[model samples]
Target: MRRLFPALLAVAAALAAAFLLLPLVALFARVSPGTLVVRAGQGAFRDALVVSLKTSLIAHAIVLGVGTPAAYLLATRRFRGRSLLVGVLELPLVLPPAVAGISLLAAFGANGLLGGTLDALGLRIPFTQAAVVLAVVFVASPFYLRAAIAAFEAVDPRLLEASRTLGAGPGRTFARVALPLAAGGLAAGSSLAWARGLGEFGATLMFAGSLRGVTQTLPLAIYAELNVDYPVALAIGALLVLVSVAVLLVIRLVPSWTRFASIWPTASAASSSR
Candidate 1:
């Protein structure tokens, strides 16, 4: 039965792949290659791509910079309500993007709870590029944070001790030791966040108006095209799938950074070695 396990898993995997592939195959089959080309050449598509790339990058930066400290604290320390805090951070991960959109509107919309005060400063968040970034961060950061926390948790504690004994500062130890070891997981998680942010539609549509070059990203463009141009929508749909697959595959290619970590077993290792 142990030897037969591989065959069983293979069959399951094949079925899953087919399920995903069939829809893509059908979508492309319905569109002419020429039409796909024309859709790609359009200004809307280019603009959406640019907006997506820019905001997603900004969102990811915020996640990485903020999430690192949070993850590290969670991994190394514990207190009452730590788990609750983590859960709160992760709530957006499982939330429907549309619901998230509505929530954002309630908080930041023109007539939102704090809208009047913000308006006094001439600040408008909803239906703008900044709103899109907030939505992306809300929906996508949890995905990255969950993975990042796990990665930080997996790091050996002893190495941190050893670094301290050697007079290495906290910043240096994190940069040279902890971070290099967790690089692969970070990369994978970052890519997942980017992918989610890229495909985000519900939140983007609800918070930021799908105003072509203004608020529309690729996914929004596809949603818009679907209403009036089925072929164009189909083409963009196929493009999205292609982009997602390409990104995921690239992330999976990163070799593990665990080897560097394996060399450190404890904080006392540095002193003992000498």
Candidate 2:
């Protein structure tokens, strides 16, 4: 019975892998390496690529700065409505991108929930690069925070106590002890956040609009190309596939990163013993 189950599981996995990868294989097969190079060099493709990279990177920075703290707070403390807060933080992950767009628009639009307040302050947010960043952050940050909270929670409380007993201040202990122990997990989570942000589409389009050289990111351009040009769409799709593969590879590479991060402290402890 056990042997049969293993064999059945293997068959299922193989079927799933084939189902997912066959389309990608066909798409890549359609593009010769030469055509890829040509498209990559074209101004529109290159510009879109640059915009995607910039916005995704900025979104990632925002996540790391904001989500990391939020995760830490969730991990280390218990308080009223903590779980509720976590739910709210992760709500975007479940939202349809178009709904998320409308939600943002209603909250921060020119006449939105907070629009009056923002208008009073003479600050503009919608239909801009900042809006793109906001949309990306909205859809992408939860993936990071969830992973990060798990990571921080896994750190040994004893180690933190030891640092405190040895006269480390709260900030020093966090920087010198907690952060090093958790860096690999944080890196893995951050990479995933970046990947999610990079692939963002509907929200960005609705909130930021598809203004070329202003708000037209690669995903936006890909959507635009699908209506008018198939080859351009294919080319953009190919580039996105490449970047997605790279980021997914990094996410899978976390085990190695954890192994490496574990090595340094072990080495130092061994040296002290010697």
Candidate 3:
């Protein structure tokens, strides 16, 4: 009975893997390499690729810069409402992308709460490149933030205490010790955030209006091309899938690499001592 159960589980796992991979294989089969190469030279494709790269990179920078400190604070401190605050930050992780767009609009759109003030100051966010960046950040930052918090929490407290006892300040200890120790996790989180930012569509479309050359990222461009240029859309979709797969590979491999590297040194030292 036990042997039969294991065989059944293996079959189920294989079926699940096939289910996930078949669509990707079909997508690739439908796209011609020659067409992809030709379309890659087109101005619209180039512009969308550039826009996606620019906005996603900037959004990732924002996530890393802001999320790191925020995570460190959450990991190191305990205060009233801390859990509530974390829940609020993580809300967007589970929130529908369309809802996130609407929320951004409500806060920053014309006639919104802060919108009038921004209008008076001659600052506008909606339907612009900045809006695309904002949308990406809103939907993607939480992934990095949550991972960062966990990474910081995993660090050995004794190392931090020792750093402090050696007269290092909080800032120094964090920069010198904590950051290095948590680098792998942080990289994984950043890659995930970048991938999310790259694939962001609904929030960007609703908030940024998909203006060509200004706000039309890869996903938006794919939508725009579906009716007018199906082949180009397929090419772009294939490119996006490739990028996404690369990011997923990094996210999956980084933690394992870090764990093995961490363990190897400890094992070696123990063996030498024996």
Candidate 4:
């Protein structure tokens, strides 16, 4: 029975691995290099790629800029409703894609809560490229914020005190000490946020209307092509698979790289002393 238990566990693990990998394997196998090359040159693929890259990058920048400080505050402070605020921010992470889209519409749509204010300002959001960016930010910022908070929380409070004792202010200590210690986590979180933004679909489609060269991202392009141009969809899926693999690899390696970087100066100093 003991031997059988280990064997059963191995079989289950193998099955899980196979189950996860089979779809990716089939996708890559179906997408030939020629098909990818051909699709890459096509207007639909090119335009969607450009839009996806542009919107996702812009969204990533926004998330990092706004989310980092917000995350730091949430991690360091003990304020009223802090937990509630975090839960609200993280709500999008688990919300159904369709629900997320509707939530955005309810908040920003023509007759939504902010609609009259936006109208007074003559600012249109729905069915535009800006809407796509907003949707991406709405869904993706939480990933970064969650990760950044965790990263910030992991920093040594003593190190923070030491910096303060050394005459550093809050901003200086965070910028010089806390941020460097948390770089690996920040990178991993930023990559995840960027990937999430890149792959945003339902929310973007609902808000941005999927117009090619305007708001159609790669995932949206894949959806638009799935029925009419299956081969192109396959190519885009392959591209996403590749990008996802690279992101996962980076997430896995970043900690090791950070550790090595942290130790290198110490090792060099020891060698010089010897």
Candidate 5:
């Protein structure tokens, strides 16, 4: 019975692997690599590719810059309504993509919550390239923020205390000690957020309007090309798959980043010498 159970589990695992991998295999099989390169380099595909890379990278930078501090705060502090705040921050993770789009529009759309204020400032957000960035940030940041909070929380509290004892301020401790120790988890989170932003579709379509060269990203390009040029759509999908695989590879290497934790003691020594 034990042997039979193991064999059944193996069969199920194989099935799951096939279920996940076969579609990707089919997508790449549909087009030759040379054709994919040609299509991806020409016409609207090129424009969409450029826009996606630009906006997704920008969104990732914004998340890392802003969300890191925010995550650190939430992870290190115990305060009133912290749980509520965390819940609100993570809400986007569960939100439907269409709903996420609508949420952005409600917050930044002309006639939205801040619409009048933004217009008064001469900044229109919806249906522009900036709107694509906003949409990506809105949807992708939660992934990073969630991961970052867990990473920061995972740091050794004793190291932080030791840094303080060594005359390091809170900022110095965070920058020199906590940040290094958490690098592995942060990299993992960053990869997930970047990939999520790269594949963003529904919210961007809703908020950015899919204008070629302005707001159209690769996913939108894929949709636009599906009926008009099936081959081009497949090519774009293959490109996305390639990028996703690269992100996964980065995630696979995150354990190596744990080696950065060794820097914490070095930081404490520097602080002691000061």
Candidate 6:
């Protein structure tokens, strides 16, 4: 029975892998290199790719700038309502993209809660490039924040204490000790956030209106092309798949690279002492 159970699990795993890979295999099989090249040269494809890259990069910057410190605070501090705060921040991680879009609309749309104030200041958010960036940041920031908090928490408290003992202040200790040790995890989180931002669709389409060259990211472009130009859609989908695979590989490789970097100096020092 035990042997049979293991065999059954292996078969199930293989089936799962095949299920996931088959669609991607078929997609690439249908998209020839010549078709991809032709689509890539089109203005619409170029615009969508450019917008996607630009907005996602901006969103990634926002995530890193804001999420890193916020994560550190969450990791090291134990204040009242901390759990509630974390839950609220992480809500977007599980929230449907459509719901996220609606929430943004309620907050930032014309006649929305803050719309009057924004209008007075001449700052419109909905149906613009900025809205696209906001949607990406809204959905993707949680991934980086959660990962960053875990990474910071994983760092040794002793190291922080030692840095403090050496006359480093809190900020200095965090900068020198915590960040270095947690860098690999941060990199992985950033990659995840970037990938998520790059692929964002529902929220962007709803809040940003899918305006070509303004809010039409790669995913939106794919949707626009699906019925009108199926070949272009397939080509863009293949590009997204390749980018996603590369990001996943980077996420998988970063920790090993960090580990090797940490080990090399110690080994060199040991050899010198010997």
How far residue 229's Cα lies from its native spot in candidate 6, in Å, is 1.0
User: Over the stretch 1-274, how does candidate 3's per-residue lDDT look in tens digits?
Assistant: 7699999999999999999999889879988778777887787788899899899988888888899999999988899999999999999989999998998999999977789999999999999989999999999999999999988988888889999999999999999999988888888989998998999999999999888899999999999998998878889999999899899999999978987777426546879999
Model 1 lDDT per residue over 25-74, tens place: 99878877787777787777777778888988898899889988788788
Model 6 residue runs over 4 Å out of place are: 1-7, 263-274
Quote the lDDT for 153 in model 6: 93
**TM per prediction:** 0.84, 0.89, 0.91, 0.92, 0.90, 0.92
Query: Candidate 1, clashing residue pairs?
Result: 158-266, 158-267, 162-267
For residues 225-258, write the lDDT of model 4, one tens digit per residue. 9898898999999999988989999999998898
Candidate 4: residue 216 lDDT (0-100):
90
Q: Candidate 6 at residue 72, lDDT?
A: 96
Itemize residue pairs with steric clashes in candidate 6.
none
Model 4: CA > 4 A from native: 1-3, 263-274
In angstroms, the error of model 3 at 20 is: 1.7
Tell me how candidate 3 scores on lDDT. 0.90
Across 1-274, the per-residue lDDT of candidate 6 in tens digits comes to: 7699999999999999999999999999999878888888797788999999899998888989999999999998999999999999999999999999999999999889999999999999999999999999999999999999999998878889999999999999999999988888899999998999999999998999889999999999999988988888889999999999999999999988877767326545879999
Candidate 2, residues 1-274: lDDT per residue as tens digits? 7699999999999999999999999889877778888987776777788778788888888899988877988988899999999899889889999999999999999989999999899888999888999999999999999989988888888888999999999788888887877787888888888888989999999899888777889888888878787787788888789888998888888758668656446646878999
1 or 4, greater by TM-score? 4
- lDDT against the true structure, per candidate, is 0.84, 0.86, 0.90, 0.91, 0.92, 0.92
TM-score of candidate 3 versus the correct structure, residues matched by position: 0.91
Clashes (N, CA, C under 3 Å) per candidate: 3, 0, 0, 0, 0, 0
Return the lDDT, model 4, position 88.
95
Candidate 4: C-alpha lDDT? 0.91
Which parts of model 2 are misplaced by more than 4 Å?
1-14, 264-274
Q: What lDDT tens digits, residue by residue, belong to model 5 across residues 47-145?
A: 999999999998889999999999999999999999999999999999999999998999999989999999999999999989999999999999999
